[model samples]
Each structure stands twice: as C-alpha cells, then as structure tokens.
Target: MKANDLNKWLVQERARLIDNYLNLIQKCLGGTIYEDPPLQALGSDKFDPVLREYGWDWPSMAHTMIGQKRLGNIRQLVESVLGNGIEGDFIETGVWRGGACILMRAILDAYHITDRCVWLADSFEGLPPPNEEMYPADAGDNFHTFNDLRISLETVQHNFQKYGLWDQQVRVLKGWFKDTLPNAPIDKLAILRLDGDMYESTWDALNALYNKVSIGGYVIVDDYHVVQGCKLAVQTFLAEKRLSPVLQEIDGVGVYWQVANGTSSS
Candidate 1:
C-alpha cells in the first residue's frame, strides 16, 4: 500500500479502538449517554420557560460530546484534588459560540462553586495560517477564515448572556492566543480546555498555562483526536517535556490529560 493508504488505515483503526473503549465505559457507567442538545433547544421559543432560564439551547449532545466528556472528567479530577476546598479558576483558549464555557459555568453553578471564574479566550476569527512544521499535510482548509463565519467577541459575550452567565465571573479575552494568553490574570488553573484548531494556537496556550495548571488539575485538548496536527503537537510537546500522565479518550474525538503532582514545568 502507498504511505497515504497506510496512514488512512491507521486512523480508522485508532478510531475504532476509541469507539469500542467508549462503548464499554458507557455500558459500565449505566447512565443515559447524552448527545449534545440542539442549539435551538435553548431558544426562548423552543424550550419551556424553566429550561430556557437555565440556558438550555446549545449544541446537541452528540455535537458536543468531546467537550462534555472533558468537562465531566475535569470536574471529577478537580473535585478530587481540592476535595471540598477547591480554589482555582477554569479557562478555555478557543471558544466558539461559547458553548463549552457555558457548560462549565453551569456545572459550577450546579455544584455551587461560585468562588472561581471561567475565562473565555478566543480571537473570534478562525484558524491562523498553518505552519508546515506544526500542522500535518492533511489538515486542509477546515477552519473558518475571519470572513467566512465571522464570530466576534461581542457575539460570544452575547452567547454567555443568553446562557445566564454574563456575570463578573466570566472573562472574555479578545485576541490570538499568543497575544492574549500572557496577559491573562490567571495564577493557577484547575481546568484548562484547549480547543484551538491549529498548532501555533495550541502551543501558545500550553506554554502560557500548562505550568500554572494546579496539581491534579485537568487539561483538555478538544481537537486532539480528530485533527492529526493537533494530536501531533500535543504528543510532541508532552514527550519533549518528559511529562507522562494518564491519557483519557473522550467521545472518540478528543483526549485529555490529568495533570498530576508529578507533572513537570520543564
């Protein structure tokens, strides 16, 4: 087989393995494995008044499984780390429509965690030009250009407001990862979600925030499994830093890292 054919086969095999693993986990857990709800479900016209009050019109369960899984896992990890006295904020580097951030905020409210903030960072514009060294050859033009589906900072802020999260706890940073990450006022993070679809964005996020990730915190990579370039960047960075933590598979599309106490800043 040609190299390209072999690569395709490999991807298929990995996906199959991930799917099987998730099936087993779900069966064992014995709960309704929810797909993300449709975006319209949260709308005032579609949802009941009670559900609408909770910001229910978001992506369907299947659409946001990776994010939901990451959030669930991170919440468990953070609870374990801090026990009943957790004291750190949540952060997401690439928020689109603010769905995941809203979920995080909602979860915090449900758990009565009002002390911590949820930092939402994004350029609102889409992916940056691919760096040949950082991105794989097959990534193509999957991301939106700034003009294609121009999502602005104001738009995402409106999303938060729609979800009843427009409080002082939600901070929106408007700029590229490199430009905005360094200036973020975060000192220690309990959960850091990286959803940037490109290598430079992912790398910049990791560089700026990984060290600050509290021991026993969680770092979620939203595009790691679906995008080879993203997976490559994360794996390469982990290897170079000599940090080895448990790699958890989420929804066959994303991978998360549990940042244990042994995780190195080096």
Candidate 2:
C-alpha cells in the first residue's frame, strides 16, 4: 500500500474507535447497559425512550441526569468545536456525576488533542437554596431539598476514573457558581454546558463564563425549556447582552447555540 493509503486507513480506524467509545459512554451513562434502576417496575421494559430522550427520568446509578439525547448533544457540540477550530477548553457548570465531562475528556483523548481542558464546576453538595431576594425567578425552588442532587466531589472524581479518562487535562472548580464561576481559571471555552437548573445558578454561569466562550463555540443549556427558572435566566441574559443566537434544540428540553463573533457583551 502507498503511504497515503496507510495514512487514510489509520485515520479511518481512529474515527471508528472514537465512535464506538462514545457510543459505549452513552449506554453506560444512560444506564441502558445495566438492569433497570431500583425503582423501575420489575421487568417493565427498563428502557424508557421518552424519558431517556429528554432526560426527564433519572437512572439511579447512572452518571448523568441529562439522558441520552442531551448527552449526544454535548458530544456534538464538543466535536463541532474541534472540527471548527474553535479555540479554548470545554466546561460544564453544575456537573453531576461528571458524566458529560468524562465524555468530553474521552473525546479529547480519542482525538489526541492535548491543549484543551475539560473543566467541571459544581458545588458537589447539590443545588443551593434559592436566593429569592436576588433571583426572583428562583423563588420557592426546592432543588436544594433533593439529597440525590448532592453528589460529592470524591464520587465525581471516581466516576472520571471509572472510565479511565481522568488525567491532568481534566480539572475541577468546586464551589457554588456564585463564588466559583467568576474566578474560574478558564481563559476561553469552546463549549459551555450549563445544567445548574435554576435562575441563579444558570445566570451566574452565563454572567461569568459566557463571554469567555470563543466565537463559533457552543453554549448548551440542559434545562432551557424544562425549568422555568433556567429558561428565564437564559432569556434574561441573552436580552441583557443583546445576543440573539439561533438555538438548536435537543430533545425538546435542552438547547444549544454557536456563538457569533460579535455577540460578546461589552
């Protein structure tokens, strides 16, 4: 075989491996590869396509709550950044179980890209009680009351290791978004995924990190349509910044958009 043929074959092989690796990540994280979680009706067809498509039901032992479609959305955005030469790292604020970040890191490894980082910013103690005084949209929110939302930092780190994707390029920013996002070490981001699930959490992420997203990068809102507070925060920030990027929907609940060059707020 000629040298060009060998190179083509190598590229094709790598692509196939990456595809397979990502598919497995989806199944594992979605809990489809395992028996139905504890609460599912015994033998009730463990797979719930509608819930999995929109991430409406949380699998007891799965690493993510965003479901298969949203997870696939993250994969698409991260790959889009790599393909388009978008400069900077990838970050998911409000990371739970670190599934999305794990996938991001795994993708980077498959592509052999070393410069970019995968950052997870989360409280690791679950959502904060709504600060109604400051964020009216979050008033009466009860996410803070859910113990399941509180996945410790140690567990998330273990999740990263479970996939053998933990490495120097994957970092963590632990604290509430209000305290951590403004000081996040990222210089620029190719993808900003927000799953904070409330007005304050969502708004804080955008206020601190949205401008740092590179032009042509992506901003993925995991709860844009499902959570009233999240939706409000997204709309309010876009209006405040005068950014009107066209949103791409993910299973009707999540949305993403590529940043336009001049969309950065002054």
Best by TM-score: 2
lDDT string for model 2 (195-249, tens) is: 9999999999999999898988889998899899999999999998888778888
What is the C-alpha lDDT profile of model 1 across 1-266, one tens digit per residue? 99999999998986587445444333222112432234442243332322322223333322222333554554455555446454578898887666567666655654466788889888888666665654554356456543433467787777667546678888878888889998788888888889887767788898888888876677888777766767777877888888876777765666677676667331
Each prediction's TM-score versus the true structure: 0.68, 0.93
Give the range where candidate 2 is weakest over 10 consecutive residues by summed lDDT. Answer: 35-44
Q: Rate the local accuracy (lDDT) of all candidates.
A: 0.64, 0.86
Q: Could you tell me which residue pairs clash in candidate 2?
A: none
Q: lDDT (0-100) at residue 237 of candidate 1?
A: 82
TM accuracy, model 1: 0.68
